[model samples]
Target: MKKRVKWTLLSLFIIVVIIRIILAFLTPGFTYESYFHLRQVDHITKTGFLNYNDDLSYGGRTLIFLPFFHYFMAFFSLFLPLTIVAKILPNILMASITLTTYHISHSITNDENSSLLSAFIVGFLPILFSTNSFTVETLFLPITFFIIYVFMNIKRNTNNSFGKSNSLWLTIKRKKYLYLYIISFLILSLTSTLTFLLIIGFGIYMLLSLMENKKINKEELEIIIFSLFFFLWVQFIFYKNSLLQEGFSFFWQNVPSGIITEYFPKVSIIEALVLVSTIPFLTGIFVAYRSLFKLKNKKSFLLISFVISTTLLAWLRLIRFKQSLAFFGIILGILFAPFYLEMEKYFQKTKLFKFKEFILPITIILLLLSTTIPAINASLKQDTPTEEEIGAFKWLNENTPTDSKILGTLEEGHLITYYSKRKNIMDDQFRLIDDVDKRLKDINSLFTTHFQTQVLSLSEDYNLKYLVLTPSAKKKYNITEFNYLSKQCFGLIYDKETKIYEVKCELK
Candidate 1:
């Protein structure tokens, strides 16, 4: 039975990898945001350092971020092409969440089949279906869950050791997990600011224990305290300049107030249910409500704490939309184990007990179908650059002068820098830019307004030399053609599905 479970888990991991690799090949290049990380990896590979002072992004601005994920990609790029490393490595790291989910579910349910089902649910989770997103969260999610698994084992070992004869061996095992948890957490902290979600979840867990008149584990309390201080110190070291410069507003990452709503939009219940799948969303919520309110199921409180933390932070608009949803989906996936086990146990007492064998397969099939469609759809629908767009950028790289600056929408900013090898007036990295809000307004006016004089004045102010007008930009500004654009001022340079215009008329 154990060997069967092991092989099944291995097969599940491989299946996920194969699916994602196939989906990645459906696009010519990665999503727009991936080019930024690609550029960072390229720099790290060439210069052996991160380009913190990026000259091309936002037209020469200092970027503040954690560098561990970039270094991670750079390490693999030492042997292979950076593009291959980007497409394959992220999917593999993301798929490893299956292993972590399996262990977490097994620990809670003590049933291998139920745990396998949990792994399958997470492997195809719709919110995690971005096969082309080369972001820190790919590495961050699996590491965070591995830390949670290690932490869970530590608590379980401590509980099981009470009055046991092999106490010394148990003590050694607990120490091993303790070291593993700390190491995994350090990696997570260096990877992204999302580490705060775990730290905050720990706080909520302790508070829930106290409110319930339950004693918190001594080791858990000590480790939570250590994590809190260690996380603060590490963040201070990396973001000291921004922390002192922006003060309390640093929590917002200095995002322009005008567009903060877009970054952290409120996720509706229906939207979240569709992303996480209807069964797991409903089952997990049921399990959480039962655990907290009636059954007082302390065993599931740790997972429930995360659900609460993610919900609270998301509600407060502290976490970004997609990230919050992804984390929520993972926690709910792990929680499904307990709910499935309970259902299995309860069914054995009813007349449906005769049909128990059929139930498991049917439920698994339902989950498989529910999540698979959304996963494939999400991967196919990724906002990657088309072949025509790449051709335009390559032409600009070959034909344009070295000092040319390209104007694109916020989404196309990184693509302009990476493919065209030219300076971009703005990109999504909003940290430490004093004029971010003004830049956003100006970009909007340049694309949407009908005033030619305003466009020329703004163009000269930023030293804009070329402008890209793609179908996306047309849809964004709700204009089929720029009425103010004429041959005297905006000379069309490269024309295709994606067009580029050279800025000709100078402001007098």
Candidate 2:
């Protein structure tokens, strides 16, 4: 049974990685935001440190971020190109979600087949198939789930030996799983601020357990307290200035109110069903309801709490849409194990038991069809730089001065810096900037305005020199060309699908 489980996990990991890599290699570059991460990794590989004082981004700003993810990527880039590390390592990390989810499912259901199937469902989850996204979340997701699995096993060990006289520290020292949980939790805590999601989930679980009159495990409560304080201290150490500046808004990462909606878009029931797939969505909901009301199931309470906490945060506009949905979808996939176990139990007592052999295969086929199609569609539709855009940026890098500030759409900010090796007026990193909304509006005006005076005015204030106009920019600003272009001020320099214009006339 252990061998079967190991082989099943290995097979699912291979399949997911292969599918993701094929889709990823379909393009020459990754999605726009990936360039930001690629640039960070490259800088770290060269200097053995993060570029907190990034010279190019936002035309030179002090960046605020946790360095673990960048350093992790940089460590691998020592042996390979950063681009190769970005493309391959992220997919491998993402694919390990299968193993983590399987262990989590098996811990809950104690049925290897159901756990393996759940792993398969999560491995191909559509929202998770952003194969080209070289972001922290790739490491964040699997490590977070692994931490949860380790935490759950700690609960199991505590329950099995509650009356033992050993102290908690002694128990942790004696049992390797306890040590593993602490180490994994430390990694999760440092990986991203998203670790707060788990801490919040733990709080909610305790509250729910109290409401239901369920007996809370003392060891689990102690661990939760440890995790909470430890996580808070780590975040404070990293984000002290951000916390002081943003206050409670730090929870939103200081994103401008005007664009917060873009990051944390509301997900409707229908949209969510499509995102998480039909089977896990419906079955997970069923299990959550049954566990909460009918059975008062203590074992399932933690998972339900995480699902609830994620939904609550997403609804409150706290978590990013994709991040929340990924968490929600994985929990539902694990919940499917309990649903499957229940269904199998029911089948054994019913006359329809003869058809049980066909159930897992049919479910797997349905899940694959539901998930794989959307995954491929999303990968194809992902907004990445074209060959022409890459060519234009490379030309800019070679021809332009190193200190040149290029203005493009917000999406092109990282692309400008990464490829052109120059400054961007503004990019998506909005953590500490006080004037993000104004910057965004100015960027829009720079692209959309017909008045040369207004263009030059904004450009002068931003210290902008060059402007890039691409299909994406034109489409974004709803313009055919810069209507204010003239021989006196804006000189067309590099022209292709992407156009770069040098600002010639200085406004005095």
Candidate 3:
């Protein structure tokens, strides 16, 4: 690809990202998860501390990714309302992430066309697009791509070589190779845990490296060790502080009772292996057997590394996040860019029809549909509070005092409290619950007065405020007496007419 073509692709990716950002803000993301994070952002913005819950993990570290984004909104805050910007800005940043992946993919293969294809793969992806509208998914994909891009760059250029003509591992240029590995690991720790697979790949890449200087120097070993230690230190501090401070340790449980029957059933060991390789069933078995003796040293090494590492990651994840290996599939697809380009050219030269003729259309359709179909259905099908809910939120925003805490039976408590500039006892995200056991008990207590008192006693023990009654919560948690008490003691300050009610905490 020429310089003009490269810039044009990058420019187009930026424009598509801008469009996604526009769509994200034009309407509220309207997701249960988005609202949870939006409210968390508000809590951090106002209090400069995350006090909504005592979970140490739920703090400002989310802001590391927030810098380029948050400040952009803050720069806009001279005139616009700050809360509104906080709500809209994450999606915009997500759009930028899409663009970054495209650029990175393009850089890796030195193929402008492939880069554009990967970008399109990202752009038309419905989950990725929707991810931009919220925090969790938005942060993971972009960060994952960025880390992968960094690895590819270091892989390609450590020997000071560039372009598609070379794929040699004899280039572990001492600390240059190790430095990039360490940086990739650190970035992965900061964002999503998916870097673990990438890290394993990089480690294999390092060990398989044909070191021209065969002997190791003490200095080089120390630098590599130090780089690794530094990354580990940072991750340990973050995880230990976050998890241990809340006084909980990790545990494993039996697979969900409901999972065994689903197509998504803890993607069994066998199926996961096939999915990760996309290896042609029993045909792959034959290939592995034959290749054991036929291939040269380098080919054997590369084949083994790719197969073994990918299979291990897939099996590990299939049990926990059965469908999560799809991201790994995307990475494998990108890695195939160079080889695909070769095959397309070969077929075009030999055959009557242009191999290149239908490749773009096919890739685009498959990629976009893969991403968009699920995303569109999920978006359309999701249930959120209706107009009545919005009306109630508005009413509370205008009428209630900023400091007035409310007991809301609706999930709306967190977001309402966020926008209204009040503190919340909790949000729907499990991370916000410092004591998951206690929170679960509070949830169960919703229907019975005895249970409701257990809920109220926490307020009495601390300083209580208002009780909010939503029709949804009444149906889900409580029915008669608790509803009556909520009506009598903490009378409705605002009613959404759909049966959602916000009441001031008389107990507080």
TM-score of each: 0.98, 0.95, 0.64
Give a tens-digit lDDT track for model 3, residues 454-481: 6566555424455555555556564633
> Which lDDT tens digits does candidate 2 get at residues 1-508?
5887788789888999998888888867988888888998898888888889988888888898887889888999999987888889999898899988988888888899899888988988878888889988999998888888888887777667444476675476537777887888888887899999999999999999899887887878988999999999999998999888878888888887777888889877887887788888899999999998898888889999999899999999888988999999999999999999999889889997998898888877888798778877877777787878888888999999898899988889998999999998889898888788899889888988889999988888988999999988888777889989998898999878888899998767
**C-alpha root-mean-square deviation, candidate 3:** 7.6
Kindly list the per-residue Cα lDDT of model 1 for residues 88-181, writing each as its tens digit: 9999999999999999998888899888888998999988988989988899999999998998888888777455578888888999999998
Model 1 worst lDDT run, 10 consecutive residues: 158-167
lDDT of 2: 0.87
Off by over 4 Å in 1: 162-165
List lDDT for all candidates, in order.
0.89, 0.87, 0.47
| Residue 278 in candidate 3, Cα distance off native in Å | 13
Q: Which stretches of candidate 2 lie over 4 Å from their true place?
A: 161-174
Every model: Cα RMSD to truth: 1.3, 2.3, 7.6
